[model samples]
Target: MKNLYDLVVIGSGPGGYVSAIRASQLGLRTAIIEKYQELGGTCLNVGCIPSKSLLDSSKYFSLAKNNYSSHGIFFEKLFFDFKKMMDRKNEVVKNINNGVKYLMKKNKIDVYQGIGSFKTKNILFLKDIKSLKEKKEIQFQYCIISTGSKPSCFPHLNFHLENRILSSTEALHLKEIPKKLIIIGGGIIGLELGSIFNRLGSKIIILEPMEKIISNMDDSLSHEMQKILEKSSIQIETSLSVSNIFKENHEQISVFAKYHNGKEVKFIGDYCLLSIGRIPYTKNLELENIKIQKNKKGFIHVNDDLQTSVKNIYAIGDVIGGKMLAHKAEEEGLYVVEHIVGKKPNKLNYDLIPSIIYTYPEVASVGRSENEIKKDKIEYNIGIFPMKILARARTSGCTDGFLKMISHKKTDEILGVHIIGDHASDMIMEASIAMEFRSSSEDIYRICHPHPTLSESFKEAALLNFENRSIHM
Candidate 1:
């Protein structure tokens, strides 16, 4: 008799593993399948976790290099070991990977070490590992497809398989920082990774095809980030498209680009980091074999309950698209499991989800941007507060951006909150929670926030929304 499960989640990413654990907690026999030996998918293994690890380390390096003297601390020339930095990142990742493994054990969830795909609504096939030839099948009452995404490869590059040309995964494990690094995209990944290596003394240049970096974000926010990057000595070239990439010398890389008007420019770098973004990694699953469907962008479509077109199968995470945040995937995982267990989970508030960019002074936002509101012709009140006015930011000496709060002018309901400054990622959660409760700006203003803290920015912004009176601002 073949093995069976009440729930089988493929991909072992934030969605897959969390769904398996939740299902097991619900007293359902559950299993999770991962292609790699390690359990956590891209978020844990190569993407979010590793990126954050490097971001933290690089931030420390930046602080030590730039601000330590201002704090009345003087030291000899500081040095950072690139190999040690990578080793530390690997150690953090391994620890988290082990934690996931331990969670599976504690939850008594069976973990299959191979890629899993549906053969039918209730059946799945796992490729045999030892023989590398045989196929094994398992039956499940329900399944979650959490197969994540891979870096979207640019076509014109001829695809450098060399170590020097790296995706996010390869970039995370690099032993040495390239003296000159060319980043191919200006999205979150490109900026975050570029910021890291640049802080570590790499001459970094970000090539973005769009008119600005972080094109999906508010134009003002993108320009703010561009200014910060420029101030940090990172060159950002926008409105440029990559035509091709070729090898110049054995070590030097040639990048060819064309402007909007057919003007061509070339750049030579020691290494090229491609961060064009990622596409759903559903190819290996042979989704067509079972009639699993995907969108035009290759993302699998899922209903509010995260149910796929096939009733017994579901999809989540980067595979399902949106803002590809790990927390979003984890929420979907839990929500889907609850949905499977006969509980009608609350619909995910897509607009309320927050996105964070781990650049120097982190950027985070929830709900709509002012640009979106204006585009929709909505009458809104925009409240802006410079982080420099905040006591916390002045103490930290890291005030580089401001918080912009958008609210319905008539209703005073907080429509959106966007921030780009110290601890913005951490602070945005409060705004997200408020938005989740449909809290108005007046309501947030009524709630007393601790003074001399970063969170006061939220209260001040809220105050500014209704009345033009921000105490500090």
Candidate 2:
């Protein structure tokens, strides 16, 4: 009875820990389990936080090396300390990890460091991660499974960290900058890491199996991003299916691929990074003991209320498989907690969840894409405004990318907003909020935005969508 809880959350990732905090806030006796020595999971430990830290450091170095001269600022013998950059990133992650620990203590949520496996519908056995020996048993009235995901590797290739074949995790902690890095996937992870090394003076070659990089985004975004990256001297090879990856020697690696017509090619590099995607991590949860259901892809099955097949057990985040973004998982975690408390919270609006890629120019989008709108056979009006034409872009000298807005043809209601430019990550909320309130193009256009700002592009695009004309252009 001392080990009993109203809710037990497995995994201390964004979803798991956040849910536990929320449950505690709502007066539910809660406990959270994490296998790792640290809290915050992948996003904090090796994913978003560290990647962004490196990105900012690399970007600053790049600006001094490339752009500063144009602004009449010059530095003699410019150099960057790669080790210091990595140290800062590690420190940032450590601070956040401690912050999460503090939150758990402040909320009075019991934090168990071990693997939690379901012993029965109402109980779990916590086992030592290394020895796999049972440490303790936990009883709960309800459980939330927030175990996140891991990076996926090629099915045919046997990958090892020592072989120079790396996932995002290994890529983030390299001892030295690679002279040549070959990336196997051109999604967010690949492009972001590639951008970092390319800025730091590594030759980057991105091989994407799809027709375009970031193929899941809007077509305009994919095309424009590819062009921008190419201009930065990052080589992109699309429509090439990789057949084999092997270590050529202690100092080199090779990746083999073929064209659609079967022309074979070999790419050699010091390091080969696989950034294809991620798969649900449901390992060691012992779901079978409780007979909870999962989909073919190993994602836990959740109904409309995010309840698993076993009603008392619920799952959220990457384990349930939707966007897999940290914020998405956090929202799901909050929703699940609120639902458990008998609060009639609104169902999550998946469409309004914005997607962002933190490349040099950045990319963000909300609501339906142009292709999705077309596929749905919705009559729509589109407006595009180039960044180069803006005074703010000229001032900042980052004149690459554009803002595109789509609206219903008859009603003039905004359908989607997509942007690729500086500060686009933060700028996307305007569109998301607009779409959340079902605002029309006219509404955005009428809202006064400050002069000479990146966000003005949004207003201009809205005006163009509403009346097929923009004042700036």
Q: Number of the top candidate by TM-score?
A: 2
**Compared with the true structure, what per-residue lDDT tens digits does model 1 show for residues 1-473?**
57888998988988889888889999999988887889889888888898999999999989998998899977687888878888898999999999999999999999888757657778778886554453688899988888888888867443443647788888887777888999999999999999999999999999999988898876768989999999999999989899887778778888999989889999999888888888888866777877777899989987777888888888889998988888999999999899888888898888999988999799988889888899899999978888989889999999899888999998988999989999888999999999999999989889988889888888888889999788875
- Candidate 1 TM-score, true structure as reference: 0.97
Clashing pairs in 2: none
Model 1 off-target regions past 4 Å? 129-132, 156-163
Writing each residue's lDDT as its tens digit, candidate 2 over 1-473 gives 33999999998988889999999999999999999999998999989999999999999999899898999999989999999999999999999999999999999999999999999999999999999899989999999999899999888665566788899899889989999999999999999999999999899999999989999899999999999999999999999999988889998999999977789999999999999889999888999998999889999999989999999899999889889899989999899999999997888899889999999899999888999999999999999999999999999989999999999999999999999999999999999999999999999999999998998998899999989999989
Model 2 quality (TM-score): 0.98
Query: In model 2, which range of ten residues has the least summed lDDT?
Result: 154-163
Clashes in predicted model 1: 0
Determine the C-alpha RMSD for candidate 1 after optimal superposition of all C-alphas.
Answer: 1.5
Candidate 1: C-alpha lDDT: 0.87
